[model samples]
Target: MIFSSQHLLFSSLLLTGTIMSISSTSWFMAWMGLELNLMSFVPLITSKTNQYPSEAALKYFLVQALGSALIILSAPLMMDMDIFSPMLLMALLLKLGAAPFHSWFPSIMEGLNWPQCILLMTIQKIAPIFLISHLVTQTSIPEFVTFSSILSALVGSLGGLNQTSLRKILAFSSINHLSWMLIAMLLSDYSWLIYFFFYSIISASIVIFFNLQQYFFFSQLFSNPLTSFTKSFMSSFALLSLGGLPPFSGFIPKWIIIEAMAYNHMFLPLLVLIFSALITLYYYLRIAVLSLLLMTTKTKLLSPFPAQFFASYLTPSFLFFNMFGLLVPSFFLFF
Candidate 1:
C-alpha cells in the first residue's frame, strides 16, 4: 500500500512538471519544470530493488542535468548572438534522445521496468520536443537538424534488426520516431504535436500489452501460455499499425507528413523516410509472423483467461485509434 501511494504521488508530480514546462512562458520556468520532473522520476525509476534502476537513474540525471545546464547557459547568450541557438538545440536533442546523442537512451531503457519505460518514452518527451518547437521559431531551423534527423531514422531502422531485447527495439523505434517528430517540427506546430500524440498512444498500448504479459524479449512474445489466433492477430495488427502500414491509424500521421514533404518537393528525404519505414515494417512483421506460427497447435487451451481478456480489450483500443484518422479524415485535415 505504501509503495502504491508513493507511485501515485511521484506520477502526479511528473504530470505536473510536464504540464508546467510545456505551458511555461519562459525558458527558466521550463527548465525548473523539467528539473522537477527529473527529480520526481528518478525515485520512481526504481520500483524494483535492483542495481539496474540505480544505474539508470544516475545516467538519466547526468544527461538531464547537462541538458538543463546548457539551456540555462544559452539564455544569457540570447541577447548578444544567435550562436547559442545550436547549443540550446543540441541540449534539447540530447533530451529527446535522437541518434548521435542517443547512446544513453537504450541503455537506460534496458534497466527500467515497463511502467518506467512508458513514462520515459511518452511523458518525458513532451517538454523537450515542445521546447524545440518553440526555439526553432526564434532562429532559423539548422541544416544539421535535417541531417541528424535522417541519420537518426536510418540508425534506428538498422540498429533494431539484431536486437532481441524488446526494450532496446522500442528504444531504437523511438529514435526513429524522433526523426519524424523533428521534421514535423520544421513543418508546422500541429504536425509535431499530432505525431507525438499518436506515437505516445500507440506506444503505450503496445507497451502495456507487453507489461501485462511480463515480456522482456522478442522470443517471449511467442512463448505466451495463453496463445490464441485472436491474440496473435491483434498483436501483429498492433505492430503493423505501429510500423505505419496503410489503413491503420499509425499510417495517418505518416501519410500527412509525406504529402506535406512532397508538396514542398523534398523528394530525397521522402525516399529515405520511406526506406526506413519499410525496414521497420520488416521487423514488426517478423514479430507478428513468429507469434502466429505458435498459434497453429490444434489443441485448444483456455488456462489463461485473464490474459486473453486483456489482449481482447486492448487490441480494439489500438484498432480504434489506428483507424481513427481514416474514419474521420477531418482530424488530419484540420491539422
Candidate 2:
C-alpha cells in the first residue's frame, strides 16, 4: 500500500525479483532477477533529497557491484565446484554485509534515514538468502556459513560497542542477524524466509517511528525529550526481542534454529553463536543506556501528520507480522 509511484515500482520489482529468484532452478535466471532488483532499488535510494541518501546510494551500489561481479565470475563453475561455491557464498555474505566483510554496512546505514534503512535492512535481505538457499546443498559452503555467521555475531556485538549513531548500531545488528540467517539457511529453507519476514515487520515499524519522532537518529534529532528512562524501557524491550528472548517474535526463529543446529551436532558453532549473541546484547544494552539518559524534561511537540486511514490500517498489519514471528511460528506457511 505504499503510494508513491517510484516506491510502488521498486516494491513491484523487488517482489518480482524475489519470486523469480526463488522459483527458478537455473542459477543464471535467479542472478538476473537479482540484478533487476538491484537496478530497481537505485532509483529508490537516489529519489530522496538528503545528502545521506546519496552516500547510501553510492555505498550500496559499490558493494552490490562487487558481489555481483564475484557471482558472475563463478558462473562457469560446476555445482560441486569446491571453493567456487564458497566464493559464491562469500559473495552473498559480503552482499548481505556478513562478518569480516561487514564494514560497509554501518557506513551505508548511517547515511540513510530510518525509513530508507528499514527498506534496506528488510526487503534487501531476501535476494541473498534466496541465492544462498539455492547454492547450499550443491556446495561445501555450510562450514563457511557457520564460520561467517559466527564472525557476523562477533562483529554485530563488538562493532557497535561505542557507536553513538542509532542507524549504525542497527546496521551492525543487521549484520549480526545475517549470521543467524545464514546458519538457519543451512537447515530449512522455509526457516530463513519466515525469519526474515517477521524480523522485517517489527524492525520497519520501530524505525519508522524513530524517524517520525526525529529523536537521536543518525547523529541528528539529538534534542530528544523522551527521557533516558523511557528510551531504556523501549530499547530494552526491542533488544530483548533482538536478542531472541522468548515471547518476542525475534526469539522463536532463533530458538528453532538453535535446536536444528544442535540436533545436527553443530555444537561449536552453536556455542559460538550463543556467545556472540551475548556480545550483541552488550551493545544493545549500551544503546539502551544512552537512550535512557534522556532529560527529565518535557515540552509540547508539534502536531505531526495525522495517520491516513491507509497508514492506520497498514501499521497494524506490519506490526502484526512482528508479533506473528513471536507467536505463531508456522503462520507464514499458511500464506
Candidate 3:
C-alpha cells in the first residue's frame, strides 16, 4: 500500500481508538472506542485502485456492526442478568473471530493487502481480547471459552491446510494463535500479553517479507525466478520462526504457555493445542521446504538484481531477532 496523509490520519485514529478501548473504565466508553476503531478501519480497507477492497470493507463492516450491536444491547443487562454475560462473551468472540464464528475472517483477509491483513490479524484484535480478558476475570465462562479455544485451534489449523492464498493462510494462522492466547489468558494474567507481544513481532516480520516480494499465493514462491536464494532463505526462516519451531523466538511464548498449562493441570486442552500446532507447523515447513530447497532457477535475462540497501539491512535484522530472540526467555530463566 501507498502511504498517504489520509492513511496516516486513519492509522492514528485506529491507534487512538485501541488505546481508548483498552484504557476505558466503563463499558460505554469501551463501546465508543470500538465504534471509533471500526469506522476508522473501514476507510483503511477501502481502496481506490481495488474493487475487492470495497467488498471486503462491506463484509468487515457488517460483521463488526453486528458485534457492536450485541455489545451495546447486552451491556445494560449484564449487571442485572447473569444470562447476558454469555451474550457479551459471544459478541466478543465474534469480534475476535474465534472458532465457529471465524468463517468471515479468511474471506475478508483474502480481499485485503498485506498491511491491512497485518492490522486485521494483530492490532485490530487488542480491544476485543482485552475486553474478553475482563469478562473472563468477572465471569465463570471457562467451559464456553475453552470449547471455543479448542475449536478455534482445530478450525484454524485445518482451514489453512488446503489454501493457496498467503493471506488466507496467515488468517488461519492468526486464529490458531488466538487459541493459544486464549489458553494463556486462562493460565495467567500476563502470559497472554507475553504471547501477543512475541506473536506480533514474528507475524509482522513474515508479513513484511511477503509484502516486499509482492507474493499473494504459494505458487509464486516456486514460479517466481526473480526471487534470489538469500531472500527465499530468509523468508523461509522467518516462516519457520512464525510456526513456533524450537529455538526460534516464536516458540518462547508457546513454551511459557505450555509450562503454565501443565502447572494448572490443563492436560486435555494442552494436548489439543499441541496437536493443532503440529498441523500448523506442517504447512509452514511445506512452504519453507518448497521455497528454499526446490527453488526455481533464475533466467539470465530475468536475473534478480542485488538487494536494495534498506531491504538488505532490514531482512538480516529481522532474521537476527527471529534466530536469537529465544535468548530473552533463556536469560531470564537462568539469571
Candidate 4:
C-alpha cells in the first residue's frame, strides 16, 4: 500500500478528472473528463503482482470506450431528436453497471485491489450518475426509467444470492443501491443526493474494513483471526446499515425517499423497491451472522501499531456517525 510518486500523481489526476467531469457545463468537457478518469484509472489498475489486473484493465477500457463513444455519437442529436435520448441514457447506464447492463461489474471488481474497488464503486460513478440525473430532469421517459430501475433492483438482489466472493456481493449491493438512487432521482427532489452521500460513507467504511482484514472471500472472514466479537458486531452493524434496515442511518435516506414516493403516489415502484431491498438484506444478514458465529482466537494477521490504532478508531467513529441519525432523527427531516 506504499504509494510511489507515479501512483500519487495518477491519484491526483483521477480526482481532478472526477471533479472536472461533474462540474463541466458542456458535453465535450464532460467527455474529456470521463476519458481522463478512465485513462488514469487504467494505469493504477495495472499491478506487477497479478494478471487479473491486466485483464480487468482491458475489459474496463473496452466497455468504457464503448460508452464514451455512444455518448459522443449521440451528443449532437440530444438537442433536436428525442429518439437519441435513450441512447445517451443507455450509455450512462452502462457506465454505472446498472443491470441488465451489469455483467462486467463483478468480474471487474474481483480483479481489482480494495482501493481500486472503492474508486470503481464510489468516485467513478459520479460523472455518469450526475449526467444521467440531469438528463432525467430534462427528458420525459418515466416508464423506461422505472423499468430500468426495477430491472436493476431485481438483478442486483437475485444475482448476489449465489456469490461467494465478497467483491461480487458488494458489486450487486451497489447495483441495488443504484436502483434506490435512480428512484430518488425520478420521484424525489434532493433525496437522491442525500442517499448517495450516505451510501458513499457506508461503502467506504465497509471497504476499509475488508481492506484491513485483507478479505476477498466469504470463507476468509471466518479464518481471519482479527475478527473478534467487537469487530464482528461493528462489521455486522455496518452491513445492516448499508442494507437500509430500519433504525440504522442508511434507513434515513431511504425513509426520505419513501416519504417522497408516497407524496408522489408512486406506490407500485415503491413496493418493488421495498421488496428488492428485503431480498438484499438477506445476503447481508447471512454474511453478518457468519461473522458473529465464527470466532478464531489465534492471531495470525499482523498490522503495524499505526494501522491498529486507525482501525480501532475507525470502527466506532464510523458507526457513531452513521447511527447518529438514529439518536437525533430530526437532523435529517429537512431533506
The number of the candidate with the highest lDDT is 3
Candidates' C-alpha lDDT: 0.84, 0.72, 0.89, 0.86
Task: Indicate whether candidate 1 or candidate 2 has the larger lDDT.
Answer: 1
User: TM-score-based ranking, best first?
Assistant: 3, 4, 1, 2
Candidate 1 lDDT tens digits, 126-204: 9998888887666555466787789889988998999999999999999988888888877888888888888999889
The RMSD (Cα, Å) of candidate 1 is 3.4
* Residues 284-327 of candidate 3: C-alpha lDDT, one tens digit per residue: 99999988776545453256555563457778788887887556
Model 3, TM vs. native: 0.93
Where does the lowest 10-residue lDDT sum fall in candidate 3?
A: 295-304
- Number of colliding residue pairs in model 3: 0
Off by over 4 Å in 1: 1-3, 300-315, 323-335
How big is the RMSD of model 4?
Answer: 3.9
Clashing pairs in 4: none
**For each candidate, C-alpha RMSD in Å?**
3.4, 5.2, 2.9, 3.9
TM-score against truth, every candidate? 0.91, 0.82, 0.93, 0.91
Query: Residue-wise lDDT of candidate 4 within 221-304, one digit each (tens)?
Result: 787665566667778888999999889889999999999999999999899899999999999999988777674233422332
- On a 0 to 1 TM-score scale, where does candidate 1 land against the true structure? 0.91
